[model samples]
Target: MAAPARPYRIGTGAGFSSDRLGPALDLVRDGRLDCLVLECLGERTVAFAHRDKRADPAKGYNAHLEKRLKQLLPLCRAKGTRIITNMGAANPRAAALKTVEIARALGLTGLKVACIEGDDVSAIVPMSTPLYDEPGTLADVGLQLVGMNAYLGADAVLPALEAGADVVIGGRLADPSMFLAPLMHHFGWRADDAALAGAGTLVGHLMECGMQVTGGYFADPGVKEVDRLADCGFPIAEVAADGTAVITKLEAAGGCVTPATVKEQLLYEVHDPARYLTPDVTADFSRVRVEEIARDRVRVSQASGRERPASLKVTVGFDDGWHGEAGVSYAGPGAQGRGELAARIIEERIRKAHAVAADLRVDVIGASSLFATAGLKAQAAQDVRVHAAMRSRNREDIETLLWEVESLLCCGPAGGGGYRGAITPCVMTKSVLVPREKVRPTLEVMIA
Candidate 1:
């Protein structure tokens, strides 16, 4: 494809489900973006939202949906920057309506909000879809199913853009597709152009994490120190029609965007470098090229891809069990030894009381916890904390296990203090594959 007359600027507003709101607002107010996207929601996040929908239908979408739209609608309207987001989680329709309400409340008339849906395949998933990793189909574990959603792609989002939507809301669309759709819509790129789509997808992946490509998670303190981390700005990609992109944050923005940061993000959460599968295309990152073309700017190009996958990856969430945890603090001399002894006491007490959980752990927070104690002894910490956790099939088992640890405050360790415990419902997740044709996503518009 020939290069466009001018590159399109896309700004990543939100990376995850609970990213900071102020930085995203900064992007809309000042980033000069053609499209602003919030790539919220993880694999199991929609499933959790599904359970929320079951309790109260209006509560499934992003909690800050109204507040965000109310604040940005007028600004985005004035800037002519379209907004795209996967904040819909399990309920895009509700999200669309909520946006309308916010717009009307702000007296912003003639605003078009589009809701993208049909990604939920929970009803049909139990028919024949088998787990991607483990054996057996969803029917075998139907009783345990909490929620199921198929990952949708860019094609599913194009119609909303075509509808002249001021804002687009999506439920469980792929993370990159929120940014990829605008690129496809603006450039008129064919869906099957694997290389072009791959390039765009690469840009989406890089920017999807918001500040990660701009040094949020890349900061390593002394080794990879960054500037003004508290005020770190989200990334913006200037994407050419050829699918090449230059990543950078706003001038005077607080984060680094060196080739080192960009390079690390390229491989984050990537399972297979050769076949990074997505609903839009199977991107090949093996031969991709990255270079620092300017200060705080990195150019990404030559991302090749093959044919798209026939099946969509489906994430299934179910009731894992119960998890109960409790913690205590040890201080002064011999704190580490006291912490270790407290952990052992909790484990032994649970075992003796027949409240031992199926899986149990005692962690010494200060010494020999993360690395595990397997070798020679080490010096005691000035202060140490002991945390114990247990997982079981029911709340009673977990609670029983936690109570044993909580009792340690008075009955077990000498310096045991600050006791705390809780029993919470735990959800497990598994992956499966469903035919691409089965999803059948749709886009519907709501105007205010």
Candidate 2:
């Protein structure tokens, strides 16, 4: 493949699983995007989908796959825009079949949907796969492991794109790799083109979250003010042959795209600006230039890259038993003291029971629910909500703790009201690295 003289335009559709479908339609209709990537998988989301797969072999893909395809496929096909997504979750073949169903229903023929798989390398991962942020390994993760998938890079999708697939459905690839695959395919970048891959990865990271680069989550009135936030737009990247891009949105869209918004998104979830690791390459955003070239147009250039990691990070999910939480509100004068006392009484009861005190967390919503720290400013308001959350390996422990919190309404606090309580099953995750050679990433295409 040869690099094109003209630039390529790529737009983001859905950022997360529940992203607005309307904004994606807006991009396909007007953004003039050569490709649109709809990212729908997160770390824990795929884990949950894995659990579904365990129950039934064919039920592991993204829940909104059919609806999203029904809404976007016909439009994308008509516009000659290649669509890519990680909605394959635990099952790419299943997702592709659903895409086929959608295409046939819409009377669209010869639509080629590619399903990229081989990211799930649980067989290669050792039983004692060590956790990145914890002391123990998967051995300590005593629950039933639903999924164990590697974060694949964009390299596998190249074959499908080269074979002229219109849509590529991937499972458990890195978030940025969704956009990186299209960029690499369009630019004909070599696997060894670390600089090019790095720049593309940077562009992918900036656009992966969809509207964050378009002012979706960067809003703070009177501080980081954003206009028309109710209908915020998604991001579009105008990529040059060199992999540098201008992050912008659809014309006359609700959200504004500027350098500030791009900067915020660039650093989101990035631990180190010098070495941002991804499946493709290690990106260096430290020396990148951010300039507002035009209204709602931010130019990000000079993103450097290093060699890809020798190993891929695999996220493993296990059943963590149950989580129980309940909250009760206290209003009027002396609400602060009452809320604190209620939280304390709930904690003491759980401690007196068999549940671990360290596994429990109590917060005063009107005081410091966020950050969950002791020194944060406690707002002096007439209303306060006391909340308690507990995790236990057994469901009974959480149920017992939640019962104590619910009891606060009738027996503990003077003005406690609005009692809410619930119990939920939680799937916990641990990160491990598997050798790149172990993951056999492949792309399979389905034609209609």
Candidate 3:
């Protein structure tokens, strides 16, 4: 494939699992993008996806996949924009099938949707596998294994693009690689070209989080004020063949893309600036340049790279039982004191009365919740909320915890009102490494 004379334009649709759909639709309808990448999966999200797949084989992909694609497909098809996404979660084939059905229902005849699989390494990894982040083996977790998926890189996605897939969906596709694959495919970038890989990875890393670089997460009202934040737009990357990109958003969209926003996102999840490891390359963003050339447009360049990692990281998902939370707010005089008293009461009830041996936590929000573990305490405020939460392998234990907290409405505290409680299934995740050769990605295109 020859590189186009003009820059290759791409944009992000959804950043996280439940990211707003309006911004994505805005980008697709007007951004003139060659491709739109929807990065929806997170570590815990994949774990929950496995749990979802366990309960119902037809489920497990992103919960909003249908809603996103139902709106995105026709617009993208009409605009001649390809889509690459990791919305497949724990099940790529099913997600692709669902896409086919949606496309058919929309009267999108002969639309090609590629399903990429083989990220699941549940059978490939053993119980004795040592976790990369902690000092424990998989067996040491003592939780039911939900699933294990290796991070598939641009190499795994390139074949589908080569096959002319309009939409490419996969499980555990590396976040950056979703963006990198399209660039490499469009520019005919060699997999071994570490420098190009680094540049592409840089573009991916910046754009993968959608609006983060466009001021959605960068807003600090009265400090780093963003105008019209309620209408914040997703990011767009206009990439040159050499890998430099100008990160910008729609002219009519809200939010500003200044150097600060770009810089914050550049180092968002990077533990090491010189060696940010993705499946595609070891990106070196330490000396990357960020230049705000125009309003709501920043040019990022000088990102370099070394060889890719020898092993691919695998996210091991486990069924972590249930999590319950209940909160009661208080206001006016002595509100802080009442909230703190409520927190203590709930703690005692869960620990002593219920005798539930779970990981229980109580916090007096507006007083000392966010920084409680850091030993930082805030002065008492007139408005406060007593929040109690717990996690347990047994559903009954979680229920008891919730019940005891709700009982505070009458049993304890002077004015405990505005009570809210919820119970949700939980999932835990761990990282492990596997030889890259062991995980083989397979691609199949389904037409609708």
Candidate 4:
């Protein structure tokens, strides 16, 4: 006889803050969910991680994630709810150790914790390469590789579960893997199960950003009384055996889970509705349907998926060159005219100084037809505010532009008093894009 289906109820907790763990723990303690997913990374988070790694490699892992996890791990163990998260941005091994230490501190022994590695691509970014092949340009233009993390797939999580891991952590795994891991663990779904994979992909997309899927990003006109902006709830999926799930959230949580919210989240960050790519599978978003089942619940079903490719594309950045931007804002009456005059005066000052301000372009905002190429409509208004910005290849040129800008405030326009504040200098950084073929994934099994 086969084991009965272990239908799982999944929910995502608030991100990066230890304060959120209390409420999250309450849900788990109440037996509301079997797994907790957390998302705490973005472009800005990666940038911060880069800075921290430069300052101290030991501090590179997101500290906030550890703090919150520490508070929730004990509760998860008590409630039998496993944890999976993407807190391991630049350092997975270190993060795993920290989680183990937290579990040990809580007196939980034989707790297996796994770290999924091989996502970093900091060293091998090619000098001239785009993120996608020809006809699909959005290459890593000047985006310096502070760090590279591949979105690992669901297959990686099964090993941790097989090893009896109470909690599995990874760095830069696909957003959907957090949800897919539980399904793979329970249903024993193969990687090629298109329908099951599609269900997992849909679940991941719905809860990847936690609150955003529930109602935080919901823009429906029917939900007038619901306070979307305050105390918004994160999404939770009660997945059944037949590759179907009902999306809901914590009771009394402040967000609505209407079809509109689910629809908007389905469309978030998606380029094509037909084929949504992920490391585990290529999900067909068009086949999925969202139905408003109740006041705060929605049913997602009929999702289909395609097979995943063998090799995963990893995003790596390298040092290419340097670039910087500086700007000054002008406000009040006749601001447009004064801004134009100030730009001319600043350019003249740089020319007079014989400074090598290469590409020292100046512009007056709030002026009619100034940015026609950018498709910005020119509108007439009194007391308009103008913003002038300049970009350069080196810090020296930016410094020269800064000095020239100061001179204009003194002699360019009568109302140049808005420029009296101190000028800040910015560093120029460049990024190089590299392919996944250039980097390899390193897998290791460890006991917690």
Q: Which stretches of candidate 2 lie over 4 Å from their true place?
A: 1-4, 133-135, 353-358, 377-379
Task: List per-prediction Cα lDDT, in the order shown.
Answer: 0.86, 0.87, 0.93, 0.67
RMSD over all Cα atoms, model 1:
2.0
Candidate 2, residues 1-448, lDDT tens digits: the string is 9756777999999899888888899899998889999889988998888888888888788888888889899889879899988899998888898898889889889999998999988778887878886788888867787779999888877887898998999888788988888888877788899999889999999999988889888888899888798889898999998988889987768888988898898899999898999988988999999999999999999999999889899999888888888999998888988999998898888887554554888899887788667567476657889989888777778778777778877889797899889988788888988888878988778887
Residues 291-381 of candidate 4: C-alpha lDDT, one tens digit per residue: 8878888998888788775556654433333343344556666667666666677777666766564665565555643674686644433
Each candidate: RMSD: 2.0, 2.2, 1.7, 5.0
- Compose the digit string of candidate 1's lDDT tens values, residues 1-448: 9654698999988899888888878887888889999888987677788778889978799877777777788889989999999999988888888989889988989899999988888877765667798888767765477778889999999999999999999888899888888999999999889998899889998999989999899888789999998999999999988999999998778998998999899999998887888898989888889999999989999997889899998888887788888888989988898888988887887787674547888888877666675644457786888888788876777777777777888887688788888887777788899988878898789889
Q: Candidate 3 at 228: error in angstroms?
A: 0.9
Residue 103 lDDT (model 2): 93
Q: Which candidate should be chosen as best, given lDDT against the real structure?
A: 3
What TM-score do all the candidates reach, one by one? Answer: 0.96, 0.95, 0.97, 0.78
Candidate rank order under lDDT: 3, 2, 1, 4
Q: Give lDDT tens digits, candidate 3, residues 1-448.
A: 9655799999999999999999999999999999999999999999888888999999999999999999999999999999999999999989999999999999999999999999999888899999997898999999889899999999999999999999999999999999999999999999999999999999999999988999888877679999889999999999999999999999999998999999999999899999999999999999999998999889999999999999999999888889999888888888888888888888777778878889999999998999999998767688898888889889998888778878888987787788888999888889999999999999999999
What clash count goes with each model?
0, 0, 0, 5
Error (Å) of candidate 2 at residue 149 is: 0.5
Highest TM-score against the true fold, candidate = 3
